[model samples]
Target: MPVVVVAWVLLILLGWSLVYWPHLPSGFVFGSGLDSSARASWTDAVYLSAVTLATLGFGDIVPADGWLRIAVPVEALLGFPLITAAVSWVLQVYPALTRRRALAVRLSLLRRVDTVGLVAGQRSVLAASVLENLAMSMAQLRGDLTQFSETYNVRDADQNLSLPAMLGVATELTEAARRSAVPDVRHAGELVEAAVGDYLDVVDKQFLRVGGSAQKIAAAYADDYGQRIAPAVSGG
Candidate 1:
């Protein structure tokens, strides 16, 4: 997301510089102690673009009357929002990324124990509680991915905190919970299953934009992280 945003800014900078390049010196007013040549260098065009887009007029160069004069303020108007959006992208993305990793960590920890067996026993309520939490986390994680689609590109070094790596395990665990005979545990499992399925649907359609079953899409999503999660995403 950050890369895309910054690229947009630089592209605009270059584009505007090209536009202003042909009309420099003659089209613009030159301040004292400046070389006001008929043919200004590319650097002068770029300098004008940088200063104008940043809304920082150094007074060394000024646009004379005509379209060039009007273009200066227009570029300045566009500059503020672009700079603001660039900063906002970094700030907004990290929180969503943090939440995503938190969910992965939670699901990853569950894989360490036999949650299915524990939920099947008389103390099923305790496991059911955990199952409910997992279901909600899955739902929240899905929402996070949807709202902050950019975080999909933000990867974690540790597989334990990587969404694509551990998400399939969450699906498999939820599937086991769904088969339990206990009403509470089974209900919680169903919730988790539904949440996971919905998550698969979102990632498949919006981000991946591929034509396939949810299982195949989920597998592809995990493949980006260098993990084979297709086997675990079977209960789709």
Candidate 2:
């Protein structure tokens, strides 16, 4: 968990540095032309970076030079996606870490059991483990759903088809675990396996969505480049 936190912090800092480091001269206004007095020092550069990246545009300090002006807009563009990626990574990993800790607690309880003649206790342990697994799975699924919801709040059909699909898988697993006569430890494992299979089916569909999106992007780029190069190719 600490590692994930540190990694995200480093990534955010690196992203900020990428946008702000180039114009670090001492107080230079962006696009102030090549000879402008606005040489941005380190502190000034960082301040300007915050304003530009945030789109605050206080207007107290402006980009008077061409590259600085160009750099400002580029930074703004990068800021949105960088911040989005950082937030998304944090949202995904935090719940996963919480689930890991919960799972560890359940496993610790499981490890102390003696396995000899403890039929009733073994059933209890099986039941507890099943519940723990289901809970963890649901937490993760909820996190995914919340993220998808936030990403597209309008709830359109194609906006987020996977959210309900994941919820359905979780519900089914909960139902399987609720079965009273799930039998001994052997069948308990089988029940867990079945639940996992359903979840993985949803995961596979998510991967397919990614591939489909990539293909669309590739086709668009190919068509665009073909148009730009067609005249030159014909002349040649």
lDDT of 1 by residue, 159-221 (tens): 778778877776676767766777888888788778888888888777777758756777788
User: Which residue pairs collide, candidate 1?
Assistant: none
Model 1 per-residue lDDT at 175: 69
For residues 83-183, write the lDDT of model 2, one tens digit per residue.
67667776865565445344333333332342212322346575646555655564554355344422222221320122321233223333444454445
Using all chains and alpha carbons, the TM-scores for the candidates as numbered come to 0.77, 0.38
lDDT of 2: 0.44
Best by lDDT: 1
State the lDDT at 47 in candidate 1: 88
The 10 consecutive residues of candidate 1 with the worst lDDT sum are 227-236
